[model samples]
Target: MSSQFLVTSRRDMEERGWDQLDFVYINGDAYVDHPSFAAAVIGRVLESRGYRVGIISQPDWHSAEPFKALGRPRLAALITAGNLDSMLNEKTAAKKFRSRDNYSPGGETGRRPERATIVYANRMREAYKDVPIIIGGIEASLRRFAHYDYWSNKVRHSILLDSKADILSYGMGERSVAEIADALAEGKTTAEMYDIRGICYVTSRAPLSDKAVMCPSYEEVRDDKKAFAEAFKIQYEEQDPYHGRTIIQPSENRFVVQTPPALPLTTEEMDAIYELPFQRRWHPMYDEAGGVPALQEVQFSLTSQRGCFGHCHFCAITSHQGRIIQHRSHESLLREAKRMTELPDFKGYIHDVGGPTANFRHEACGKQRISGACRNRHCIGSEVCPNLDTSHEDYRRLLREIRQVPGVKKVFVRSGLRYDYVLADHNKKFVEELCQYHVSGQLKVAPEHVVKHVTDLMGKADAQAFLKFKEWFDEANRKLGKKQYLVPYFMSSHPGCTLRDAVELAEFLRDMHMQPEQVQDFIPTPGSLSTAMYYTGMNPLTGEKVYVARRPEEKQMQRALMQYKNPANYDIVYKALCQAGRRDLIGFGPKCLIPPRRLKGTRPEQTPQRRGSLQLPKKTRRRDTRGRK
Candidate 1:
């Protein structure tokens, strides 16, 4: 099936004898097929204002044919947004690695899109140089600054200048997209729309015209790559909405795009986005052709909420969704669950259901609508703002309602739950409910690191908090008499982690008798605050000196500490100790697993003689002088 983007510069131009349109919205991948949803939302909002609009989803956006497919209309203005590309790239482990020798017939290689969202914007520039192209979504929003790319292993700057988009919107696109559509429809120039919240555009002339916008200097963020990488690594490993940090806005010109008031969608509006007749399989085309193996057949995913309250130093959710949580109604969630149960190959387990933070319900502490933009990105960081409310009463109701859904024999909170939020709540009922109903034998939570200093740097819960939560969880499980186990997630070699810190973690693990199977090395993703710290040894926001474990040896030691018993780790630990010149830890120091002599080698005198006769040892044993005298 061919997909096309619907765009026109003129209102009713197609109806008024125009043959084609001047603009087209391009997308990067097929999986994140939400351009259509955004388009539908924008179309509905515009129609409410008596403006004509059409929506389209161009899956293979690289192909120029889609631009022509949507019958051309007299041009007015081009508006592009939300999803520009699949943010998941080769560097993100989205693709399986295959060797050339292992290549087989009909096997696809290099499935990644050739052009990034910025590259697509550049292509659009080539096709329609004068047309307005707005870029948004994870790609454009995050990369609107100079940052490092793990795939190319190099530094990059604002995607707007690179992709050649006229303007870049930096957050959720519904409200912004609607405003842009209306403004353009009303004949407002692109320059007039500059002040819109969440939009980033380059000025035709500026004192710093060469730069896209006045953002934090690359030098400020350059040395912070390791820190940022570590932060991103923690986010991916935990997938816990509560455990992330505020990813810094790259540009001073870039203020966060705030989410509109939770437009409590009726069940019908919820159905519109979810009930769209589209392929839900992991790979729709591959499945139909029987190319997907049986192992790939069963896959599950769904979104329950749209925003988060717990913002860590390394997260972008607050910037994207705002601190206020927007939840899909319990009835809507139940309907989605029912739909999942009716799937042709439905298994009893629903893979996961969640949004930015799983347990977040749209309800706030009081009925008052919180106003004013958030100065800080995360609400639940070191200091909770007076305006912030961390209640979960409504979330509890949602979970209870979801559990009662028909045909859903079991539900799994596979994404993640904010253990800190659960622990902080006035009641322990949610924890009890989770233990008894939601968990599928294992409950995953991210206590990123055991070191307090490192956890503080990462804006995560300290050891004390994690320990308390663990104790509560254990007790809850025992009380329920359930077989569920808590799978605590951890990160290694984050910014602020030193060899000594790693050793401390090793000691902590040994004391707890916890053996971890997964240990993640920090990978710097583009456009994160921690990535800047990881690359540079200073905080991008504060410019304060921060510790970073960049050396391979230091990183190895940190990883080894997580897996002390693995023989591979023993080699890593020994090598790291030798590199650090801390020979004391090579053998069993308080933290070492290998004995000291085992690492330093035995003395000749310590070796046993083959025969009973004294073969003068390299160093003769001391004689009993008093007895001899």
Candidate 2:
């Protein structure tokens, strides 16, 4: 088969001699035929299964004309809100319109409509009435159940009902989409797909499955915070594939049924998906608009794995990809590297070679493959589990093999690396290899915070583990005669973080001589555990009260504390110090975070230890001068 992009227009379809499409995949992002993009992955997956897939990227949702570009698909209309949630893509954390969208042509903003899945699905319905519509991707996946919308600042029903989509395929849809396509090929209706795994559907009178667990109804969660917390806890717990159960939630007169996640693809299965004929770049139609900027970061990258076992509360990987790690085979990855070298744009650099968590190539523990992750326990948290196989030998070897590829000069791991897990490994070879080869002068790791109390709430591992990793990282660079540094990522204003905690974190930064280029304030995006805590002021897992900086001023102070050295944050830092009873940090002392303003001076100045001690004791000064002479 030709390694060309799937049909995007009628001309392309006509060229391929296709009378009708097997699936018309609508996406909120620009057409990028790379594997990293979900639309590309699903379209290619269907094509690989002998289905003629047509892509409608970033359609004009204001009318149905754009949806008619590919005529009508024979089987289903697959829709997704791109790789990111459309609301997040179009707006900032402050709910202001973003100026640029990397997913669009030339990074233009507002190219796609907000609430893209619903808008696109509605448009598809208008263009091809009676066509079965299937919604998936991050937006539909995260909001598969009743979810809180940060932009709207209210709880909303499942996207299925809003989009009028026939079926909702959550998580990685390669497996689910294939099954759905095969079933549709066999002349099955959307109603029969209700029993499919990793899918969701709505019904007015149909009863939920016996094995399903029901969440707090939309009315209950919307009216009661405690009920929302309880509902989110159950949803979080039942995400594991091994022990997860179908979940159902009700809104008004209908019920939304979400089946358990699809089982992870085996290594061979994963390799086959990646090995599919992908153009590996955005469509040529985008060339005039400077191509897709999103492709720059991933055009040369090789995805070695999928899924993450490090279930951070702020991350949606657990809710989307699940905690099970599905890695590609070494042969598969090496072949990709070789193929990348053949591209005309190839310059002998492979940008990245990892997934959600870089070093995770295998399951967390042996038990996970059989019994699944423990319902209530973390794989590597305050302490690494005894069964946690923190080995990097395979990862190290894989890197070596890729480095040996004929035209590959460098391979970097830019994704999140669990330093705590790296610390657990006694074999220091991976750390040394990382410092010596993979690092691009700085390795970004999310310690998130230095304080144990704050990190615990963030689902980060022990604070001491980060310190240990820092020590080993420094030692490795010293032995290797390299000057690479660890750029630790920290989050401020997270739940359970107080002003005092922010001050403590600032002091830690001072001690480390690190001034972060950027600090993230906790964003309560929907569906994550952190958002649950932000909304309810309680940790859903434990039902314990959490200290959330809800006030705008308080949140600003916490964020300002992270960048305390910035001139713009001086006032907020000063106010925060005073509020925390940390006046000692406000003086002109060497360790002070901010200098004090002289009562009558035009600008702030250094102050003596005491009011009358400005002269520095003439006798002591003379004695010091005499010693110097």
Supply the TM-score for candidate 2: 0.94
* Whole-model lDDT per candidate: 0.53, 0.83
Model 1 bad stretches (over 4 Å)? 1-25, 31-88, 92-109, 113-115, 128-131, 148-155, 183-189, 205-284, 288-301, 363-368, 372-378, 382-388, 578-591, 595-629
Query: What is the C-alpha lDDT profile of model 2 across 1-629, one tens digit per residue?
Result: 25688899999988989889989999899999888998988888888889999998988777899898888889999999888888888876556787778889999988888899999999899998999999999889999888888889899988998999999999998988999999999999988877788999998864656678888998999999999999999899999888899888888989988888898899999999898888988899999999998899889998998888787878888888888899999999999899899999999888888888888999998888788888988887665678888988889999999989999988888777888888788757788899888987777677777778778888888657877887788888889997776666677888999989999988977666555545567777777888899999999999999999988888888878876776667888889999999999987787888778523324322331111101111111100000100
For TM-score, the strongest prediction is 2
Model 1: per-residue Cα lDDT over 1-629, one tens digit each: 11322233234455555455433444333222221234333434444455444433333356654544454323332333323223333323213343311011123334334335655566555555566677766666666655576555566655765676666766555556666766776778777876555566655333333212232344444555554444334322222223322223333344222112223333455445554433344223334434422123124556676655565545555444555555566666677677767778777676666765676555334432344234434345444445546667777777667667787777777665777766656457777777888887766666778777787777776777767776776777789886666666666777888877777776676666566655566555555455667766777556578887876667767787766666546677766666656676556466665564343442323232222111111221111100000
Go through the candidates in order and give the C-alpha RMSD of each one to the true structure: 13.3, 9.1
Alpha carbon lDDT of residue 386, candidate 2? 81
